[model samples]
Target: FSAGNNENSIEAHIGINGEANLDFLNIPLTIPEMTLPYTTLTTPQVKDFSLWEKTGLKDFLKTTKQSFDLSVKAQYKKNKDEHIIPIPFYAKDFQVLSTPNDIFIPAMGNITYDFSFKSVLITLNTNVGLYNQSDIVAYFLTSSSSVTDALQYKLEGTSSLTRKRGLKLATALSLSNKFMEGNHDSTFSLTKKNMEASVTTSAEVQIPILRMKFKQELNGNTKSKPTVSSSIELMYDLNSTATGTINHKLNLESLTSYFYIESSTKGDIKGSVLSLEYSGTIDSEASTYLNSKSTRSSVKLQGASKVD
Candidate 1:
């Protein structure tokens, strides 16, 4: 992570870059054999007996019982074979079969499935940039995987500029500190005045189930935490103060997607020792498209007409 600025414009960047090579050689991986015992009720079988002696319709027909056992097995061979995988459980000739039912036999007893492949190389990168000029706010992200090389993703953001009297400012600031009892403080502040401003960021991500290729038998989880915030404070004179901020976040996953946005502003003017102040906040959050169980939003407004 680094930041620098010159006479042209102010710029700052935060990035995480990594590369990894994974090779698995004859790893002892096994799927324990599972036995499923099931019972089947066959069609009614009629009892042949002396017609007039005694059997009525209820006694004539009787249901037949049958029991069956199903065995599930996998084929894994160890002979100094190495495989590199981009994702977990990724291999060649890997087949997933459903459990057999009475009507359909998915596979015979002890079906053998192969999970073997080549080695995998993975590369990942993520970046977030804060800029004060519109022309210098666009950024590009480059990444690679076992399947593809040199994949580029473009990310763009808005730039802010402020002008007062005859002074113009374009700047980026970052501060991080750790103190007492594992407590940590981290903050990224970008200011663009007298111009339209936006924050641009990009990240390398794998969509939960789709990219991870998680099986129903195995559990997997993915979470993303991206935040964008902007605030402006204007000082017309020492007797007056004003500030405002807007923050938004959009999170998406295989099972759910969430969006949140909040904006608040406050202003105060001092009359000798007394002061008048007003503030309002609009906060909202709700799920979109996928899940609705995690949904809620709130709004708050407060103001003080007179302060002594």
Candidate 2:
């Protein structure tokens, strides 16, 4: 059991992130296949709006027009098993509680959340972001960490200089890190009422692997509507060759389909093949309509060894 409060304490920033009041209790778990024999930690936490008025979060939620979320967060983590490859099953998280938000205290419009995806120094509250910080913590649980450290106030501004009639022309700068740490393997998107499609370009530098990737994604504003959409990605590394991919999905009342393809070559011009793969799926279980096949899947491979 654990208890935290700033009322009668010397420090006002009592819990991590200077949260005036915070408390939680962690239950332990044991596993034999792991190194520690004690395998995991289960923590149930609760947050209320007692001392939040002293925080930028008070302004953040107010400006974004979002009510404070008092949801119960049960945190879980499994330590890395020395007997197995080092994959510490913990929650990979970084939150800038105060630093960046101080940049633009008086935000004009749009939701400017505490920046989480970019470069910043991590503070004591488990928020890890120091300029050029390369150490990667294994966090398998993706909801996120409880507290934050630094902050960067991203201007809630939009540029429509390139916008043309009937077509959307815009660009955005959001903060996001690698995928294995957060949302991947599945996709969940939200589109505003007046928004139609989005074209986004992103560049990522993976420090641990010394790898970098540049990608572009296009998404249509067809959530409850039936339409065809596509996303294309391009990537390059210093020691490796360039690669490109084309992925598309279609959702309609009577039909649904998806297609994806990616390839890499040894050299710029005619060169040895490196790897190529593409897969497609068609189904109706999730959609209102039914499919000729409950599920269909396929893949094509090239210039790679296949094992039985």
Q: Count the backbone clashes (under 3 Å) in each candidate.
A: 16, 13
**In candidate 2, where is summed lDDT lowest over 10 consecutive residues?**
124-133
| Segments of candidate 2 deviating more than 4 angstroms | 1-171, 174-195, 199-201, 206-208, 221-225, 232-303, 306-308
| Candidate 1, position 68, lDDT | 23
Task: Estimate, for each residue in 171-287, the C-alpha lDDT of model 2 and write its tens digit.
Answer: 333444332111122122334444455455555665543454555554545555544444444343433332332333333332244322222222111112356433222222222
TM-score per prediction, in order, is 0.19, 0.24
Residue 224 miss distance in model 1 (angstroms): 3.7
What digit string (tens of lDDT, one per residue) describes model 1 on residues 1-308? 44454533333333333332212211224344344457453444344433323323123222112122222223222223223333333335665544433332222111122122122222333333333232233222222233332232222222334333422333332211111011112222333322222332221213222111111111112223333344433322322243333343343334325555555554444333335554444444444332455655555555445443
Q: Give the alpha-carbon lDDT of every model.
A: 0.31, 0.32
| Candidate 1 global lDDT | 0.31
Supply candidate 1's per-residue lDDT for 28.
29
Indicate the residue-level lDDT of 196 in model 1: 23
- Give, for candidate 1, the lowest lDDT window spanning 10 residues: 211-220
CA error at residue 22 for candidate 1, angstroms: 80
